[model samples]
Target: MADPIDPSGLGRLLSETMSALGQFGGGPQDDVVPPEGVGEAADGMVRAAVAPPGRVTALALDPRVMRMASESLAEEITRAVNGALADLQEKAAGAVPGQVDLGGLGDQLRRIQEDAGRQLTKFTDSLIEAQDRLARQGGK
Candidate 1:
């Protein structure tokens, strides 16, 4: 006997298909302005703000950090700036409107499409074999 087809699975795929269709209804859109990302280092002695377009908009260096050598200060500044820019990338990825999260929805869609294709191919092969069997029996 064949395995039963789950209606819920089909329903979920249909829902996802509809969602994708609706999301793509409009043409290309403008980029959304992302929120600023701020990061601190050296126990908050150095703080950096990464504004939109990934530019460092502001920097706050505490007077305490001023006593450090130039090389050490440069390293601390690099650390703080890197942290802020990393945060900016994360916020920008999540801030886009109607963007499908590849982590979840994209995986589900890929699985569903693969399963559907396999099932369709299986169905077609079975039909062909059945037709061949019928033809053979009729000839006999």
Candidate 2:
């Protein structure tokens, strides 16, 4: 026989499900203060720092880099920025969960719906049975 559904247990399941879903949005990650990512190019003559959401927070060029030709200077700057963005991405990935089991969550929800449907059917059957019994007794 299937276990009887307990309202408290159903409530707890819903609470847990909501909590798990919340993690994907703004749970633990909200508290994490992501560290800035810094990168250097051309022997550290060009430096760049990036923050969360791929925003470049700072760029610095060593006085020595000024002597380089315009094209080389631009290349070094681009390299520094790209490196900083990459570093930021790597760090951010580390700070967050690697994967979310949305399929699992969907399966869980489907099970819950099935259970509710079964319970409703059982209740309806019981009500009908009771009504029939009462009608028979009244006719006597």
Give one clash count per candidate, in the order shown.
0, 0
Error of 1 at 76 (Å): 0.5
Q: What is the lDDT of candidate 1?
A: 0.77
Q: List the residue pairs that clash in candidate 1.
A: none
Could you say which candidate leads in TM-score? 2
Given candidate 1, what's the lDDT at residue 1?
A: 31
Best by lDDT: 2
lDDT (CA) for every model shown? 0.77, 0.80
For model 1, how does the per-residue alpha-carbon lDDT over 1-140 read when each residue is reduced to its tens digit? 33444546556667776675545443334553558888888899999999878899989999999999999999999999999998888887776557545566566668779877766666667677779889999999
In model 1, where is the ten-residue run with the lowest total lDDT? 24-33
